[model samples]
Target: MSVKPESASELFSGPFALGTFSAASGPAFPGLIDREGQVLDLRTALSDPALTMRGLLERWSAVLPQLRELASSSEPVRRPLEELRVLAPVEPRQIFQSGANYRQHVIDLHVAHRAPDDDRPEEERRAEAAEIMDRRAAEDLPYVFIGLPSSVTGPYDDVTLPAWAAKPDWELELVAVIGRPAHQVSVEEALEYVAGYTIANDLTDRATVFRRDMPQIGTDWLRSKNAPGFTPLGPWIVPAESIGDTGDLQLTLKLNGEVMQDESTKDMIFDVARMVAYASQTARLLPGDLVLTGSPAGNGMHWGRLLRDGDVMDASITGLGAQRTRCLAEES
Candidate 1:
């Protein structure tokens, strides 16, 4: 099925999606799309002339309602979704990722890699981690790390495995795209900064996570996770208003058609509001910035399997859409 624009008068009859895509001719552009996969040219329809996902995010407060209204009307330039190449929803200026935020995921890892000397049942260890998670949720701040924007790639692009990486892993997450500037915002008002939500596959090089030489400094996320195309993001961004109960959405990932990571956002030790607010306290969050709200349990680390050449990943979240990434080893 392919989209061919018939007339400007035939806009989508109802609700639609939005994101960045490369049309028949041009660089990466942003536009609105319907469930039927019809694209509404945002530049032509909104009379912006120059609009990207980044631009829409920058003027989200003013553009959202306008987009909604235009989508409902019948006088917008239209095209089929098949006419374009989808890119990452937004090229983020700052990428913030939450770590160890899913209680069961952390517990599962601990149970799988138990120490030889410490003899304890899985149940006891799980309970201990659960207790710590609950207290940490209520008391401690989220553990966040900065990611490189260059690591991001289109949802359907190829994931290049670095020659130096022995173990590549996937962490599927719900990514929030920031709309407005935020600095030291309270948790109550943090959600207001989000323009929309998208899916992100936070690909990591597991073998590089720790440094034997510099154990005190801990994980070197930059070397482990910032390879080109490491972050596969979005088929599209669903407006925040359309998403109901962010905490309850299911996050799932499949490697070569096998369900590996499947869990609900409810398992998050720290929710989106807290994650965003905590991030703002340290640095100013600008439009198009991304915040990945941690992955749920069942990653490759817990399953004892890492990604290899030719492995395909299909990851999805409720309503936000899915992404498929094919992995290939770097050529010599």
Candidate 2:
């Protein structure tokens, strides 16, 4: 299904958003998407015809005004959005993913995936999980992990479920795109470093999440999450200024017309600012880098319903565009 501007405008509040689009056989170019469903080719509009989305983000502060003016004007060079193929918004040099950061998501997971040998009451397990979450939120740091840029794909691209992946799952998350260089920044200043926001479906192979052979090593995120096209990111990037409140945005994911996950950013144990700040304490955040806030409750695992071949996932975040990904099983 094609993305309609009228439908997109309901969720995306921005006057315009940055996206990467390409003709049938042409190379991708940076473009500005207006609310009226028109795309202004930034290649010809900007001074540099070769400017990429990442390059635009590097000069985001300086170029923002120009983009805003262009979006408001009747730019003759604009084309119908549906005429072009939308690609991932930006090619990030780094990707930082937060794990188990949502309050109810963790609580639900603890209850749903309880040890087979532990015959405890549901209420007792829930209370214990809630206490653990509360204490972690108060004391421990956010669990952040590295993800490969190679795993990134276009919002509407097909995801190949590897043959070895017995159980694949979907994790819809809100991604913060960095504009400025941030090193050891405080939580209060972290938002200032964020240029915009986008959506990402962090697909995972549940079977590889744990290392049964080496239990001491804990979770094996690399094997579970970093497959090619595992991360379907962006229909577009909404400027941070346009997104009023990051804390209250709703995140919803539908699997094959069924609402599998529906929750709000308010359920996050650590907000975007805290997660970004926590990431910067160890590594420098550069332009176009992505910091994915953890997924909320109602994942496939929680429902005991995992992804199958030919499944379609529609993920959306408030003020950020939506992404529709189709799943295909790998050939033997």
Candidate 3:
């Protein structure tokens, strides 16, 4: 029960979790996350021009019949997931990222368990202990960091940067896809509010996450975390209906098939429902908006753990599928 955040599957279970996603060659479309980091085609179910952001939305399977009808009658050549390029499942007008969501991640990385009553001697130890609970809960909160629309990349893509950069690394993460539009919801209503799940690596710069424990860390989190190719998502977008509970799967990140980080979603202090519920209070979550759950501390950005050019990084979160990317040095 005392395992690190990398091993708990309390948050990644579900039907979509068992598959991959794919779409037309030119543009990105929603589908399922498969076993080997590829997208399973959802066909015409997601291509409906008449699709409404607001509808019955009762079950993910309700649309299957319609999808079959469209696929069989296809007059144009259908695209194969393997042949086309992949992209982030959600296309939210804006993006949001989370910070500080796992317990062992805090201690293992020396992230000071900052709290309100450190000044009160009695509360100092208690505050630190609370991090254990808060760590799991924080994954659901995501802390809301913004990103550039142009910076997103697909599964198996390259995570690259200019040689002049200070630091660059990868954080294996689970990305939550919103099913419908929502504002001001409750934890009790969170799971029902989701569309599906995807995988993401929240790469960060060492100079960014560990600076003193104040406002500066926040500044670096967004900058170092959002550079071009920092967010490698996709491969699939299994509908929430297909994926049962997302909190019960195995997640593993390996460098050349040798495990570096391994865990399950169950360790997430904050579960899925609370995350969507908490976010709706301040911001609007649209159908294509992406909520990148936080990463465990095993990322390469910690001190001696930085990434190097040519290093292969493989990230897989339970049912959402795995992503393989190579670190490349930008050309001069």
Global local distance difference test of model 2: 0.89
For model 3 the TM-score comes to: 0.72
**Winner on lDDT (1 vs 3):** 1
How do the candidates rank by TM-score, highest first? Answer: 2, 1, 3
Candidate 1 vs candidate 3: the TM-score winner is: 1
Query: For residues 1-332, could you state the per-residue lDDT of candidate 3 as single tens digits?
Result: 00111221213333223222233434434443322323334444465533332221333346645534433444334433445444554445556676656555655454333344545553555556566557545444445566665567766777786565566766787777776677998877877667677788777775655455676444555556667887777555655765677786566788765677787777666666766776788889776677776677566533355677777777887656567777787787
Q: Rank by lDDT, highest first.
A: 2, 1, 3
TM-score (all chains, Cα) for each model: 0.92, 0.96, 0.72
Reference-based lDDT, residue 283, model 2 = 98
Give the alpha-carbon lDDT of every model. Answer: 0.84, 0.89, 0.59
**Quick one: how many clashes does candidate 1 have?**
1
The reply for model 1, stretches above 4 Å from the true place, is: 1-14, 112-124
The true-structure Cα RMSD of candidate 2 reads: 1.9
RMSD of each: 4.2, 1.9, 7.7
Candidate 2 per-residue C-alpha lDDT over 221-330 given as tens digits, one digit per residue, 9 for 90 to 100: 99999999999999989999999679999999998889988999989999999999999999999999999999999888889999988888988888887888888999
Q: For this target, which candidate reaches the highest TM-score against the unseen true structure? A: 2
Enumerate clash totals for all models, in the order shown.
1, 0, 50
